[model samples]
Target: MSFMPPWFWLLLALLFFSALAGWVLQRGLKKQALSADANDVQRQANRRIQQQHLTDLDQALAEGRLSPAQHAMARDDMLRHVLSDATAAQGNGMRPQVNAASAGPVRVVWIVLCLAALSGWSYAQLGAAQTWWPLPLSQRVQITATTPEQLAEQTRAWQQATQSRPADAQAWLTLARLHAAQNQHALAEQALARVLVLAPEHDLWVERAQMKALSAGGVFAGEPWQWIQQVLTAQPLHLNALVLAGSAAWSEKRHDAARAYWQQALGLVPADSDAAQGLQQALAQATEMPKLAEAQASQVVPVLTPTPSGGDTRPLIQGEVRVTPEVQSQIGAGASLFVYAVAEEGSRRPVAIWRSTPTAWPVRFGLSDSMGMGAPPVLSSLAQVRLVARISKTGSAQKQPDDWQVELEGVKTGVQGVVLNITGR
Candidate 1:
């Protein structure tokens, strides 16, 4: 009933009134017709009686029961009496009664038809006819996930939906977010690329760019940088895009450009807001690094420009990597070694990274601020970090199921003689 159209009540009222009017008019006309029929029957009986009396008078006159003048007068009197009876009967029935009774049904029919037409018109003009129609079966039921298993099933369903409906941008977006939630950044980027092609929304472009950077080990260069630039060209004041552009510049060691981008974003946001505070912190870091390096250089007397081995004499964290005998036997000749550092808490993206293909175990490696994958959160700025060493069979940054790896937590910057082992799978 709540879904009924707004004009439904009016239509009901019209139906009631029309029915009432038709019933009342029909009942009245039926009574008048019955009465008129009764009167007509009575008048017919009287005429039959008068006609029989005239026949009897004529018979008596032929039998010589009266003179000619008497017989003629008797016949004339009988005829006058018959005419008077007919006139009285006509007066009893009203002059227009026949026409009124005949027209009553037509009036009732017209009233009903007109009300019906009006109800139809009102429904067409003021009501939603589609609301009364049944919904499709697909739309009537909704499925919601309440558990991890259900969520995984839902993700699979959306993946299938994207495959079946390749042109459906919404399906692609949902699949991308699901993959991202599961840390499958490479797949997320692939799905988001389709979304950009179909919709090309600005915010989605920024999200896709971020996902691309994540898929590439948090290095916002090449395509990711291009995506950010595209968004900035169209919408310079876009907050996320501006922040991303700054991060890209910072990763490339363009501190001044990073500062410029962050400053422009800061001016567009409120000073007391979280965004402004973050931007201020980034600016402060960018401003202090060069000064700190200058102070250290001044303090160090007779700093050598070159070492005997022609390598950086000072490194943030120097490490030696080793593999267990079981894993050493599995390592192929072309196997690559990857070492990375991440903050002790928060984001898992590596702050710095180093990659090499050493010929033997117990190889020495160094990670410094210059090895940072991105900036403003360099190795020197972190109080504590987790270092990881992995032997990759495919030489990819993304870890594989069978790769041997190990992690050391709570390691501080500038720590030396660290030993990392690839004993864990």
Candidate 2:
């Protein structure tokens, strides 16, 4: 059997003692009443018997049925009986004397003590002593402060909870993300490993790959590359995996491989999507690089944009990105900024995109169809879109804590000079 705490045992003891005291008090009261009633009955009977004898003696004397001496003797005997009866009545009629040891102040003291002990023990057992008791003002202030130590404490609590519930995939994922936000890649990877065991899904693998790449400073080699390949093998058209593959190839200077992967991804991605815009930019950049004449003749690189006509009639969306003074101070040097236009509804792929560093505040940016990822939802094709600008501390397109961004909804195609802000995350 499970053992209860000391307070529980103390509570039980108090209850038992209190109940015993109450029973003793009730029994004493009942016995006292019974004794008093019996004493009253016996006193009344003695008085009645004494009166009858006296009446008989008086009759005998008045009727001259006996001599005066005999009457006197009888009267003396009757007097003796009266005296004896008086003494007996006095002893019996008096109230039962309370035994000092059993029912007087000492017993009362024991009862009171029992009751007080019970009350105190009950309060101790049931009160909020373990949680939320009133704290001093200084202690409350210290508890509410958001210092680094407090953050570490919170992280430890989360770690403990995850340890206790190892099967909770979401919890593991959240812990991993938290570690990543703190730039603790090793710890984050450890948590992610747990997540992989608990929940093996394509999206999670893709996320792990992204994390690995970020840890490598945007290099998509080693385990991160392997993870991407695993996801692609399972799902050939996985959008994120295909995008990462293309990016990895481009980073390695394998332009042909990058072009092939991007082309495949573009076919699967929404035509007028943000992803398509990114892919288009990559493809365009690759095509612009000088090529050997013989290789160029053999391989015809696909061009997303037609040669500029007279004045370049291609549609363009222009915007200015401004950072609030309060937010600007929080942005670290060399942080990356991404500005893109995405369709307002359906797929959230960008129609066009521009990337830069935060060195220039209120930077001017422009995008056209040539910057699109694949081809479908080109900037000129969409009637309305959302223009977004984000300052990413982790150099990631994914939003994280402390990342700042601003957006304008329902912006018409070809709109010029639209202003966006980098507000607090």
Candidate 3:
């Protein structure tokens, strides 16, 4: 049970802010009034000096009414008196803030205001940051849902908001920012992806992509590096992407590559931004790292070889699917996967074909050709792929998947090192 309702808090905040503003205003007014008073004093002093001169000249004329020389001398004396008085007046009156005692109230008000602000900020930091104690626990908590359905509902609301106003890049960015804040890497990735597709010229892609990269790599396990490469191809000066790329590389011990990427990006970003600072630091560290051997070991699936007479292989499986096997099936949370196989140890890569789920032969999970893993595939470019797969994103679903099966086919060339994860009963 609480007596303070929403309006009560609202009123309190309003009053608090109003008091602060009023205090500041009063101080400004006090300063202004002091200036005005000084100006008035100067004006009064000048008026007195002129009066004194007139009085002097009249007295001298009355006493020496007989001689022209004496009258002239008396008039000169009067002029001198008036001029001296006017100078004195100008010096004192023109100096603003002649009344220092009157400003005490204003100064006190400012002090009180500062103390009030400090108190409010302190209260907010302690009570709000941890737990709101003044109100009931139910009302005090900032409600965030935990159930899968609730997440979906919230995600749906965000999606609907963007859909209703497709042109709102800021809304998209806001949603992306929210997702990034929650470490919802998949959602953030989708949001950034939308930004790229909708507004290519938007200045936020590099930044958003950087956030996505960290979120994906740190918690969610998505294709952060690949997406970053895509962003880099489009925008070379993307600050976020560069920082993310460097971080990802350095994290995995690819110091040379990280340094190179950082050096490329350092000049394009704000000097004061954390990313730029990190770039400079990474570049310095990378120079001292001893180069490691090029990574070549990979578990590979087999590829079909073309017939010398241009004839198909004896079995359709020979040409239709790739033979991709991994060194192991188990991997750690942050481990990388590499896949590659050749007919001969030294020969070039082979073509990979696709097969449906529960295939009679080895099958890859994609719509087109290319057997590949992200880690190994990124290392080389001679590989061509025309494969696409529908992967479940963000894996937030609590229920088990219905199918452990997928399909793979070929388009132009086959890729290597990709692993298919399917879970079905």
**Who wins the TM-score comparison?**
1
Supply the global lDDT for candidate 3: 0.47
User: Model 1 Cα displacement at 168 (Å)?
Assistant: 5.0
Give per-residue CA lDDT, model 1, range 1-425, as digits (tens).
Answer: 26565457657887898898789879988888878777767767887888888788888888998778988998899888887877776776633356767788898899789878887887678767445564422133233543448757878999899889999887888777766654467787898889878877777887788788877766787889998999999888988788878878876768788888888988988999866776787788667646655555544322111101113343378768888888888889988887888776554557677777778777777776546644345676678798988888987666677778888999988787788977869
Q: Rank the candidates by lDDT, best first.
A: 1, 2, 3
Give the TM-scores of the predictions, in the order they appear: 0.52, 0.39, 0.30
Q: Against the true structure, whose lDDT is highest?
A: 1
**Candidate 2, residue 237: how far the Cα is off, in Å:** 8.6
| Ten-residue stretch with the least lDDT total in model 1 | 301-310
lDDT of 3 by residue, 1-425 (tens): 35455445644875677677766767776777777786777668767876776676667677875366776886777778777865785676554455564765767677666766776777666546224325322122132544437656666776788999987765676666556444355566677677666666424554454555444333213555666677788877766567667666755656678777778888886799865665565565456443211211132322221211112111122222332233123212322211122222111222222222222223333221122111111212323332222212222211114312223333223333444333321
Question: Which one wins by TM-score: 1 or 2?
Answer: 1
Clashing pairs in 1: none
lDDT of each: 0.74, 0.67, 0.47
Q: Which stretches of candidate 1 lie over 4 Å from their true place?
A: 1-158, 164-171, 177-183, 217-221, 289-320, 343-346, 364-387, 400-402, 407-419
**Compared to the true structure, candidate 2 yields what TM-score?**
0.39
